[model samples]
Target: MSEPLVVPEVRRLGPARLTAGMDRWDRLDFAAHRRTHGPLPRASRSELLAVADRIDLRGRGGAAFPFARKARATLGAAERSGRAPVLVVNGAEGEPPSVKDATLLARAPHLVLDGVTLAALAFGAAEVVVAVASGSAAELSVPAAIAERGRDPVPMRTLCVPDRFVSGESGALIRAVNGRAALPPSRPVRAAEGGRGGVSGRPTLLCNAETWAQLALAARLGPDAFAVVGTPDEPGTLLVTVNRSPRPPVVVEVPAGASLAVVLDACGVDPGAGVLVGGYHGAWLPPHLAPDLPLSRTGLAAAGGTLGAASVVALPRGVCALAEITAVAGWLADESTGQCGPCRRGLPETVDALRALSRGAGSASAVRRAAALGRGRGACAHPDGVARFVLSALTVFAEDIATHASGSGCGLSSGLTLPLPRQAGERLAVDWARCAGHGLCASLAPDLITLDPHGFPLLRENANLAPWQRPQARRAVARCPALALRIGR
Candidate 1:
């Protein structure tokens, strides 16, 4: 049986942006939302853009791109191309360490839907799509919220995309929406440029679920009121998922310039241990590095990290840093889309090297070499992100690496404190005992299969195929003459 999904407790500190009314026992339905927070104010596209610029609102997604700039660019592209744009609300919280999006979606679904409606009206969009991961709490909550509204000015719908790590990426999400494999394209193309035939197959105004919720609040509160609590550069409350502590992980809404030390303490975590700021694709910082830094993107960047998705994972004192990093690296390797040679080849090798180093059997040079091979060489940022994460681990735990390299390693711990999911999709196995080496699988599905030193097919560690790739994978399975390959969930 599947484990019961634990809904994280919600805590609001400082001024609330997207997380207002979350303390109430009842879910904030449409009527209660309007009664509690007032109606969402309408504004012209240019006016909304001006407010966004004034507030310096950035995407709550990992990238932290300026929301005003994105809106203006997408609107400009729509006008130039004479095509209607589509507004997408991205609620796919695929990052295992982050639960802020899910918290907001489950507790305050109307707020998000209100933001979607306001954005659609501002962009003059005829259709809006709320995209969530299949079987996620947001998948059910969003549609119910939409139904509660009775009628919307623009038609709005919800779609469930594959829940892979890269699948939530903007390019991959767009590809999935366009009926293709949920993988990023080799070339960089903005969704704004090509209109209906572009990267998203439309001039799409796709923003994070939290970003939309922020927009909804911004519309109601206006710029001055919205800018009251946060720092000048990053003004507003940010929802952060705090984990790796003794207490259950909670999603807290904190002001932009709040002290990281205080936030960690509030989340029932010791502030003296190392912290993984941002999600898996982010960096690690010593306890001292975070105390003085504000929780804003600029502050975190100044302290050698980005506030990506506002996920703060406090490393416990006794946990093995090297083992934690190794497990995360292995999970990331398995999550790769296998669309690029660098990601497909370098990540697994990096995982292997890290595993060996964790066990005190491998050289640090091997880990570094494998990590370097992945930098800046993939269709998407997957390889670059993995490289950054691994390199950061090496740098932050240099002493650990040295000690482990000497062959007197830290003993393996019985449990993992890291937040990787227990189950990461399905597995593709090759029965090495059953058949002779054959290269047919590699040729049939090069993107999913590779050849090792002995010419045996090296199936990707996780056999989770995107919806569009299933038919080709099935064909490859059918043609395997040795009948030595099988898939298991």
Candidate 2:
């Protein structure tokens, strides 16, 4: 038997975090962190840009855009004299299968904080906000870490937001911090505009928390030292969330040039099945064919996939892939912030069609409906991504889909072991007995609640909208004569 790689227990911390502020914690001592991975001497903006350019450091936040280039683009806007940029460290791990961000926030909060403060210093930003999902463990843990780091006195704040997925997007977080609804705007405005409204209406620089942590690492290592491990174009190790059977969840930093085979072996992944690369917005690949592929942006890009927020999910045999996709489609529809019309109405419609396809109840018309409804009507990539995920699943699993569509046997009853988002904690629920079907709740808060065919209230999606809508949605919550609706935030 081939030996399986033992997935290490990831603390995600550079030496400093392991030491807890270069200080002592309980019986454990981490003073060596600063000695080994001490902060780099502050770099001038030009020198910082040079360091970024040397390593070709790209945003690890899925887009992977060149960091130096993005800095140049945003820096010019930030130089508007006394209107320093707003640096936002995005800690909201919205992808259900992705625990890397939350893991880092919990285990290596200082590493992330180090990156945030470094960027703020580099950008001369007046304000910094580390946004995490409200009510999540991050809400508490991140704040605690920041307070503990008071030893290093950095200008920073924390904004706990609702756990809605789309709200984690860069622009949406900006809008939410500005007291607007936590939904993507209808227009694609670059955040550099820093127009009047939120966060002092200043130029904003947003990046994933992991990306910042890497930046902190890059600063210390310098570009050449950083290039020692990973590929030429993509230097340094990256954090990946590996999900396969038998192995517990792990967050590991594999060199960029490492083979996919090494990663699989490290994670104890079994020989062959479908691999969900990237997150839901990413593509799926079969295992036997994918193992030899290099584990870099260029490598995955060559094969029509992206190394998204670093979520890799391996699906075993016997589980119905079609049914799994269907359930996720439902969850994706429910996750939308529902500020856009196409995403608001279209995602659920797409889910309805996929559900029909799962039950083998829909005709060619149903397939057409699914394809037509959610192609590109959303403000962000949410709707388009859902369409892509479903369409790809249908194409890849045509054999299984045919088995169901023919009303024969797909032989699976929605065995949803393939990881996806699920509702956690208390959420809004309606008492069916008390429902009068007046449709008032749907009308009063159309963005959140909608009326189904039975005139019963159906949740459009999870969100904590603008302050006014909060009260309005709350009023609708109380005004229901049947007292069936209750809002839980």
Cα-based lDDT for every prediction: 0.78, 0.69
Instruction: Report each candidate's C-alpha RMSD, comma-separated, in the order given.
Output: 3.7, 6.3
Estimated TM-score per prediction?
A: 0.89, 0.81
Q: For candidate 1, write residues 1-489 as lDDT tens digits.
A: 123334788887886657777666336778778877887788888888888888888889899888888888887888887877888888886878888887787778888888878878888986888888887877777778888888899998888887778878887787777778767776666876654335445688888899988888888888899988988888879998989455568889999889988888787788444788888889888877766978888888887887888898876766678888887887887677667777767887788788777667887888999999968778888888888778887888677778788889866452678787777455556778865777888888776788989998876543455443455577777788888776656
Local error of candidate 1 at 198, Å? 4.5
Q: Output the lDDT of residue 159, model 2.
A: 88
Q: Which candidate's lDDT is highest?
A: 1
Q: What is the lDDT of candidate 2?
A: 0.69
Task: Kindly state the number of residue pairs that clash in model 2.
Answer: 2
lDDT for model 1, on a 0 to 1 scale? Answer: 0.78
